[model samples]
Target chain A: MTAASDAPQVRIDGLQYCNWSREIFREMRQGGLTAVHATVGYHEGFRETVRHLVDWRTRFRDNEDLILLARDSGDIERARATNRTAIFLGLQNPMPIEDDIGLIEMLFDLGIRFMQLTYNNQSLLGCGWMEKEDSGVTRMGREAIAEMNRLGMIIDLSHAGERTALEAISLSQRPVVISHANPRWLCDSNRNVSRTVLQALRQQQGLLGLSLYPLHLPNGSDTTLRQFGEMAAEAAQIMGAEHLGIGSDLCQGQPDSVVRWMREGRWTRQAQAAASFPPQPSWFGSNLDFPKVSEGLRSAGFGEAETSFVLGAAWHRFITVSLPSAV
Target chain B: MTAASDAPQVRIDGLQYCNWSREIFREMRQGGLTAVHATVGYHEGFRETVRHLVDWRTRFRDNEDLILLARDSGDIERARATNRTAIFLGLQNPMPIEDDIGLIEMLFDLGIRFMQLTYNNQSLLGCGWMEKEDSGVTRMGREAIAEMNRLGMIIDLSHAGERTALEAISLSQRPVVISHANPRWLCDSNRNVSRTVLQALRQQQGLLGLSLYPLHLPNGSDTTLRQFGEMAAEAAQIMGAEHLGIGSDLCQGQPDSVVRWMREGRWTRQAQAAASFPPQPSWFGSNLDFPKVSEGLRSAGFGEAETSFVLGAAWHRFITVSLPSAV
Candidate 1:
């Protein structure tokens, strides 16, 4: 019980955040989320790249009451000290960094803790999880790994292609993160990481976050938060407790525009990449209004301890070990 | 004929763009734009705020056979040098700089020429075009003005609120760009500029770009491209030739995800801000791409020279003088 208040329920990896608005924070609070592994970069668009970290730092520095900017192990203690949730700034697509090696460290300097290699399609690092053909991580991908390792930035392979992700797992000196993903073996979805990859993720000492996209589930739109948690539980069964987290990818408070942008129908460039991947079904609504994930975990018969671990503790350990206090 | 080949035509004021692949370049080509002032930022969500610029510079350097990155007035020559369209990298949201005034120069060092104050809602500078109530410019906004002025980055007031924009124009030594905006007096759109402000813009020697958003027209989606052009022509009449430029505001070829992310409705905190703006009646597809701006100008009986000037020459003049050469 004492520990339950101290850390995130599960790791809660791969929270697909867009902008850090007060509205989003309100949604998080109302949804009953204390913390999230936030994606700072884009599934599409610009200006949000490195800016995500800056805003978090500003929020952390300016308002120490509700949010904590976690850079070191101490920040977690500080989070518990203030009852503020921790935000691990994640780059969903390396396209934010473009091709610069130096920026990896600079971003870490600005408090970017987690970095996803790709999302949905191709980036300089490698093909995305959704790509029809994942040729594996590219030469740039290898370099990115070295740069990330040096910068104390965690290499998150959440939205990465299978071959590329495998190569990245093998290449990365530090443990990586599949921050927001599902098990392909349980119910095959290109967006989900394969069981073999999940196994590799576990073996590599990395973490696998079960995502909450309806398309990734067997029943999809009808899938409840409990089913969503089950997907994580299945992956946990395969990857083990230490390596599993749940990424809500909760865009609940986001507008239809945000959903449209993700859907790739006709709203944004996501449309351009649709040819390379299967179109996501326009599911029920934006991120299941927050607490549903916890309800799902509870309904899934997850204990408070398990839910706590699943909710946030998983990310706490993952980030602590993945991104050291060196920065 | 010479002017037609050399002038900056259709000076697009605003489009929330990110680090695009070659596919975007092809789209621009298909759009038939002779010159484009595009943006680089995380308005959606990607990574590397400044690295986005470096990536494009490299792409332009390698693909000089096709694209050109314009910095200062010279790159326009270079674009003309290789018969490629000149690209002025604009920062849509100052979020890319992350409280660093110096980074403005660093980005300018990498070929950033234009900078917008904010995106949709608010930033350090003040309220965005979409904020219900404007906060005017902030103290930091003052510092930004000096930095941008010192660096010769033209102040873009497209997404800025009325008070902040007027303040920005007044505070700056040079003329700012209200790039890709319509006249609010004409259609009462949030994204559109007011007619009273237009008078002030002329007095301040600022450039006013006629934006193209169907929602900002008097007619709904039923409005034709010709109607959109007429609005521009009307703004041009008010602002005069030297102060006029073609700001296409084309969201075409963008992703559905981008559209989703921007609109604040149903799922988002700020989605329905523009709901009252009234979209124009549906057109017969889009007979108006960027090239249509030129053709529209011609059909309106604008002389070939003036048409060319409206397309590119006006933008060239605005940018050439707006930015400092040595700073």
Candidate 2:
């Protein structure tokens, strides 16, 4: 067994869309997290998305000691040195870009580092996981991919369909990422990726952020820490150790309404009955449970170097390579 | 000689980015223009573009008797029957769509019909006329074209570079258009379409709206009505009479700042020394000059059928095919 001193020093959550507050910021600091890819927009348009940014600006100003905006990898390093959690802004859907391709630059200028092409339905760029048919990357989707690649924005394919995710991986000049999802071979769901996608991601030197969302796990809410850790080890075996990282899709403090809003945006009128606030497993309840995951990784036989990589260094390497040097 | 009765009954200026007002609306009525493609955005982003739309909504409500928003070709027919000029909203640049391709559907819902891939500089979609090197239509530009085609939004390539314009014409599933530009064979500026681009446009059944902007005219401010008409006749011979029309590029009542705004958006920091507003040619000034252009077309020996087509019918046919039937 690894000694207590062999524990990961820098922990980074590859993806989290929490209802952020001072309480959550304190939790992150307590959890010893160096940085987090925090989602800012799901189905929000440009104006609404801007409002979210403004809110973040206010949060940064208010919680200067606890959190700072992470625009690039350098900021993540600064956060580590200062003992603050670096919050990197991301968008789960490309709605903020609207139909104008030029807005990609504008959003990049505003400090958005990652953007997904689709959420759970068909977008102008490509098919979502929830779409009836996967048509692959559309003509506009191809253009958006090029622009995103040119601007150094990480293309997140968490909620995309299999064909779209594969095409995006192939089309991007830079390394793309599945910011939050597991392999469908582990748990059968449209939201999870296939083995083909995982193989493609591994081949392309991209990253697969293992999700801890209850619905995405093999045993759902009953999943144990050992099972989750074993799954990670299995994923690492397939995707290689360097490509695996944790992106706990933890919705800390969010209500049922927010879940409904996320599942059914302005695109739909019907209430999504199945997408109610999911009961998170007791072993992994919140940000404070991050250390328990590290413990589980050690139990799964990940060495000191591998545990450190899966905890944070892998994500740090990814941001260093994926993000632009300047904001 | 064609009689006075042979005068164009349905005059439609294919492109204009006028400083729109009640006075301009009255002038459009005086000019006997049945419809116009009025540019709403040049360099504005999504929020600013929405503000412009709001302003137009107010203008339409205030001047209900003089003008109406043209959502489709049917609106144009209704405008002609009602004796009100139909104002079809267009974007001189695709900045309004920002980076979200899904906004294309939203903007279409809001009544935007025509959109240019670029204005006077490099955009996410394609290179503009002023770029040092034209790399052709970008990947995002290709997807944008496909989306525009699927949504029935007319792809306008007025200010795009030669290679970009040619590529757009070839790549578009539907017929594209150069909403305001002269043939470079007649005018030796980069702002004008090259003979190769014009030939491709003609072959692909695309329309070229002849620009009357002084800088685009062969003799600049000294260009005579006869010279302009003769140039049109020469162009008609090359592009065929059916594909030729008048966009005019009339900038009536706009301030010099608006001109500067068009030439230099947020993309550049250096002041545009040569982008100062040029003097309008005396022979062709504002909306009132429509009648004189018709007389010149007659003087150039065009038949009544050809004159009518050049004035409006061609644009009418193009819009009828390019816009969705519902709106």
Candidate 3:
């Protein structure tokens, strides 16, 4: 093995739910990605959610040379040693559990590491960011938080409402995370986090994974790396530098239907006009653009170690701390 | 209407999970049943459980002359006025909620009244009687009990483990029910309630619906009406006569596959030997056997007023007090 390949790498994309293919696996490898938390559930119930795991099993088998399914931080280290990307499964919503708290462990047993309480609508646990009246964390939500904490499964509040996120952060014994979202000050979208949330998140020592999704950018598809870096710097100022990382929120090859489903999953009958996936920022369209993010962070005044932390080191440490020791 | 028809008939079967058909609906009418708690879920998840409601909707439409779906005490009165049987949907297992405690409200909205915490093995909420070790009510179980109480959904502990049943009774604010189980003193099956559960259930002002399922009978398929009556009298001595009713778990016309599914619901692949439905006792075979139970109770030295309570009045009063007012 080459000396470069022998060195320990800690590069990780905190979150991604791309349309998987051999091509994307190749792109991940080419980008030198050490790990990626892949989304598996949005509006699915237990059985449908299990189907997603089954689908990933085939993908792992088919792309055995490129990726490994990760259960814990050790798997990420193993992926680095084997020169393959470690894939950590996550749910973008609690829909897969479908109101039963028992299914959480079943999903965890299946290798899911991260789970969001909501996905842009009212869920059983809590109101999503898009809900009109945020009811905050619900009775079920409290129970779910306790169970997730006990299991050492990370809680992601990226699409949760303000109060729900705050309540969860306060309630959780372990640090929670905003797996993929930019600051609301950077982009006025409901999907983005608020200054108050960032402060609370920082207090809990949680990580804020800055998003590269065009809609979460200030200038949308036209957002430049310099502007993105400036936003990162501001976020780092609010949430400590160590609590920042890249969660690309990349939807590399998914069609418009997937995005539409994400927005209007069985909640309404009215079809949204012109439904489609927003164009990603030019600098970060696919997995092969990790270098661009690093360059942007450095150009925005991040030190070598700080830039490295934002790129993946922070996520690696957060994940290591969040997961159960035996796992 | 004649005085007989105008009277507020409260002849309710606390539980039944028959292979529902128009013929069965006619039999229920023939039996002069005022209401029936029909089991709609056993090992189903959210969507599949909803499908049961959908099926019941169709059944209601098809048999409008015979049955009406009951949402509350008022609906039972409506069914009595219309000379039809009110069908109150219930879940034999919490599997319908799967792992999401939020689904409890969704099921309630769809007209489910009673939900047991476990079926017959280790569940997320607690242990079933079949489980080797009883872990009692789980974290999710406590949350579920609170939500159920808030929504006015009756908590049923028929098939739960001893500890789980006791924990649920202690935890629930409202009166819980053992919708279908005989006293263990009579049958000695894991499915039967213990003296401890009966005493606790009575203290909470809960009702124990004496079951007519053959397996729960002292002599199984050959159990005589006199024997059944004696068991009810013994149960009444321990539990006040007002805390008893009929929950004949009459699985009329169902194939052996249904029983197999109930016993080994994807929990084991050993494929239980000779899996089949047990034969019903000669005294109670179908919905048309309500009069036989009344006769049995009367022969067992129950006074006319107390016999009426066991026949259905107690269930009516308990259900009226259990359900949410608006519902």
Q: Give a tens-digit lDDT track for model 3, residues B43-115.
A: 8886677656767877997999999988888988889889999999999888887776666765676678889
Write down the lDDT that model 3 would get. 0.87
Write candidate 2's Cα lDDT for B1-327 as tens digits: 575455438788999988888998998999899899999989888788866776787799799999999988889878977889999999999997788676665577567899999998888999999989999999889899998999899999999998899999999999989989998888898999888988999888899899889989989988888888888898898787778889999888888888888877777787787676678889777787787887777888888888888888888888888788861
Select the stronger candidate by TM-score from 1 and 3.
3
Calculate each model's fnat, 2 decimals: 0.00, 0.06, 0.00
Model 2 docking category:
incorrect
- Candidate with top DockQ is 2
What are the runs in model 2 whose C-alpha is more than 4 Å off? A1-8, B1-46, B49-327
DockQ of each: 0.02, 0.03, 0.02
Q: How many residue pairs clash in model 1?
A: 75
lDDT of 1 by residue, B210-305 (tens): 765666565656656676667667777878766787665555455555555555423355545334333323442221345666666666666776
Q: Predicted chain A of model 3: TM-score relative to the true chain A?
A: 0.96
Model 3, span A124-234: residue lDDT tens: 999898878998999999999998998899999999999899999999999999999999987997789999999999999999999898888889999999999999999
TM-score, each model?
0.48, 0.54, 0.53
Candidate 1 CA-lDDT value: 0.66
